[model samples]
Target: MNDMAYGALLPETPREFGFFVDGAWRAGHDWFTRTSPSHDIPVTRIARCTTDDLDAAVAAARRAFENRSWAGLPGAERAGILLRTAEGLRRRRDEIAYWEVLENGKPLTQARGEIDHCIACFEVAAGAARLMHGDSFNNLGDSLLGLTLREPIGVVGLITPWNFPFLILCERVPFILASGCTLVVKPAEVTSATTLILADILAEAGLPGGVYNVVTGAGRTIGQALADHPDVDMLSFTGSTAVGRSCVHASADSNLKKLGLELGGKNPIVVFADANLHDAADAVAFGIGFNTGQCCVSSSRLIVERSVAREFETILADKMAKIRVGDPFDPQTQIGAITTQAQNDTIMGYIAQGQKEGAKLLFGGRALDLGRGHFIQPTLFSDLTPSMAVGREEIFGPVLSSFHFDTTEQAIALANDTVYGLAASLWTRDIDRALTVTRRVRAGRFWVNTIMAGGPETPIGGFKQSGWGRESGLLGVEEYTQVKSVHIETGGRTHWIAS
Candidate 1:
């Protein structure tokens, strides 16, 4: 890593890479460049693949799946490869983190933390490979036996977003492979380096040829191709609800493939009057400030008890103001650059709209020109109505909108008011209140007394328009599998016609 002033890091030169297909690097007729969001310099040149290239990658995945080169391997053998991949990731932790920072524009420390979480995904998936099992029925008499088998769902198409690219990929890849499925990935064009690097690491870890392939290009061309490809047996997508809906349409228009989507969120964090205001305030700040509030599970909406709303808002504002917004290379920087120019503009638009809607700007709302690179100071808006654009839509930036509730029931209502149900969190010392809110919040994942807590051991997905199916944990592995029932007879069956 090359060092700069203020403890920032940069690459000596822009790294060049090709698409990975059929266990080999393939060049494209055209190329696209990804500039570092935090430095405004070209950091990587990725192959610009077309629909034909997508077909090739999908064909390779289909071939690999049909041939069963990886699927035929014993569970222990598959687990061995996943473990090796985990080890390889561990070895290249820092290098990968550097690339992640350059491509995704997240703080170095936060990127490193995501790498650790990714490593755990692989490790857990390795264990799951050996432990995942189908069901057998012994209830039938000696004359007959029944069984239910879980088999890989052929070729899988994975489309990941730019935010948390590597983490989202790792969250699905190992588990899909564990279930004996082959995959072709379409990573977000701006953040393709880590996904391609992961392909190399998997190959180094002895993953079979064509078992894991990566294709890069614009989402409209290559990404939609993956979703529409009939050979793809399943499509797992993580992005905005609009795109996720399109993926569903592509599936319905094509093969009606199994879909797993983790889309947008207007997640809420409710704090009761009796709750620890200090702790709740810290969590509220961290929840929205983390990843610059570009998280699907970010607690963007804060619904505090009316009595303590003013006090809690003050504490949260102080914490949000203290968040270090600086270079991605700065280990102490809690907030980094916006991942893309368009997203920055979108966030700014939301900030403007919030003001237009009469929401009070409690803290930072202006864009920061940090010498070079797109940066936004951590922002908070109070006195927000649920009808405001910032309050309703997924801003996906370092912005928090505040709301107040006079009762627990109102808090629950405010939390469940969004079209999304990806995640929700609440702070309360009373067990009854916590239990009630957790059960009635209408989110797939709920956190009580904490925020953004959990591991790969738990499943993650959404309800309603937030999308369907789950990822991670044992269910993550099963998500890529299809179940079939089998029946066997111990005694010879008598023919009805003959009788």
Candidate 2:
């Protein structure tokens, strides 16, 4: 079969344009168009969820939780459903990829990879369901029995970002469902097609009514509703640090829901003079430029040892020049368009700010000449200090700020100076150096000689203001559950009579 024939089987357009509630699709009065960031064309018109829609989705999730259709299902049965969902995702991988590319302005190749990762997430969560076992003790005392069990934390509210709609949804929703909790997911307004498509796939995989729902709208309206919903027992959010703070405050003021947030990061890549400069430069490029630098964990800061700083900058600039930035569907495109116009402006503003702060713009420092779409050049800035705004803040765009350090201690200090500690990478062949750097870094996930090399098996989260709690692995499943202890008094009931 030809490539076009294969592509035809995939969903190029979002056929269903409504919120998924109570196991089916339903249209709303208001709808909004989702534009392709790469082409600046309307990809699909999705339902703009109102407060009523949010209430309905939340109510459905609450019903699913209270009715125990999901919570009371057998572990193996729930696992089977999840496994089927994963299989369905695999079968529709190409279509899901298309939707992701159209809605999010990521390259089609990256979108396909994201779809595969989403499937893996579901499969891992399915397997995790069987492994969610509790402990028991029979000889705690004479004729006494003790038991401990983990139960689902009721309804879950998942709010995902635009950059990685499908991947983030799978990361949170699968674990929530595996833990026997129903969910109401709110995808970012700019990128909701892939998420809505996944909701359909889940329904096709035999998820019951109210088990999973999707609401689409602005964060202020729909997302805030979910965050403040009293029935939502737990809330998992992936977004900016400012927005995450709002979620925390909302949860505290509302039902005090269990909150898990993966916020923004100005992640650093520290390169020592003795490090593998070739590998380090490649990793830095991928970490910062991939997804057009829209990822919260994107390594926006590069801290290089002064000895190798000049040579490394030359190599990095040469490499950044070669990266193709254009249509996301193109096979050769490495850096696609920025996800949104606001993000584009934000990125360019940072580039301008870097220039104003006296950082040398070694390469791109402006928007691309690409027609119509929100495209920005992959920017690299050198001669940066730790105090500069561009160096200190999370620029969520394809912009890298390089800072030179004289010693390993300074590198460590510079890397750990940011308030956000999501993830960081170190490039060094010396085992002692890698160990020392990894130990000193305050981030939740650290890499040595490699970056972004984990999947469902590895837990991903943040430290400090980067956010709280993990999102993958067994720890992710545990995060969605509550522990309960049971104790029984048998035989001798010697109470404290006089005490």
Candidate 3:
């Protein structure tokens, strides 16, 4: 890779932003500027909020939930607001994508697709608001009636990570609102712009003041505050597994608020000998290359049948080599800069460790310099054992480790060997083999012949350490709600005491 000129996509000046609270933008005690990860230029200046600010936001959400300003609305009205917000997102998709690319270091094309996915999330949530229902027992005695009611759990706290900032936020927001819960969101400080901008969209769409709030700052302060706040009824966090454990501890120490977490993953991509080599190779390339491999659900492990292992590795390496890695603004660039310097160093460290641990470097192991900003070539390692650190840990970069299995049983066992079970992909032309592997693999989301497939229509979560609860689809709306069983006498009241 050679030096590439920074294009006009770089903002000449940093855009100033304020935290949203009670339907208004408020200044913090301090402020900080965020530099674009790809261009290495100041992109946005954000308020540096503190725990007190988080408290204010939580209080506002609590008030809104108690007053029913948003919760009191009819299902049709809430759905209408969500639909309008979706339209607003469509209107500003380009601008949002630009900000996403600059701050997150993902390609412009991928960011645009994320915006579209966000829109679909809102749309699906709107339908769920209308269609979501509880159950009634009609078989009870004539004088007795039994019904189960699904009600909003109350104030919800949402903590989102830097990777897929707006996408993850939208995946939960509309659904939380649809469940009639007020929420306070704490987006990753590095990528808070889009989440803050969403405040305006929701307000313009007729959402009540205090119904939704955002506090921007470091996670240790604000995020911990959300977890410990007694008034918060639920907390949904998306980030690393270590932090997810901290969240669990905080919840237990505090109110034990309902927790919804989408945590870390060392997902696997298994390819059988009977699979289409071309399609499997392509999907494997996309699985590790997408988002520069920063995604939690990214398939970092390649488990292929030993018979086709050499051939498949060759095809996959060729595909990875041809992927364009350059400026995020460049439409032709398939892979962009690493999101942060720390992540870049981490990936490089893993590359070194793989070699030191005796795994053969099949393809890339060097970093690329494109003028400025951090970038690494798509990496692949072969002869990887299940015990290798690179094979077990989540490197969270454009790195793929390969393992060979002689039989389907070995492939399935290798895939399930990891503690993290976020997702897995199986490539096989044989339906029986696909179904068998899919059943045995201990992953939450499984794809046959594809990787990272489907949309907001289906539910997604982890199996073991991947995190608790689902985030999308009809189940998404229900996650923020609690169930209450109600019993009534239709004709006469039955007294336990003799009267």
**Alpha-carbon runs more than 4 Å astray in model 3:** 1-7
The digit string of per-residue lDDT tens for model 1 on 198-266 reads: 998999999989999999999999999899999999999999999998998999999999999999999
lDDT of all predictions, in order shown?
Answer: 0.91, 0.87, 0.91
Give candidate 1's whole-model lDDT. Answer: 0.91
Instruction: Work out the TM-score per prediction.
Output: 0.98, 0.96, 0.98
Candidate 3 similarity to native, TM-score: 0.98
lDDT (10s digit) by residue, model 2, range 255-357: 8999999999999999998987888898898988899999888889999999889999999988888888877777888888888888888888888888999
Q: What ranking of all candidate models by lDDT puts the best one first?
A: 1, 3, 2
RMSD of 3: 2.1
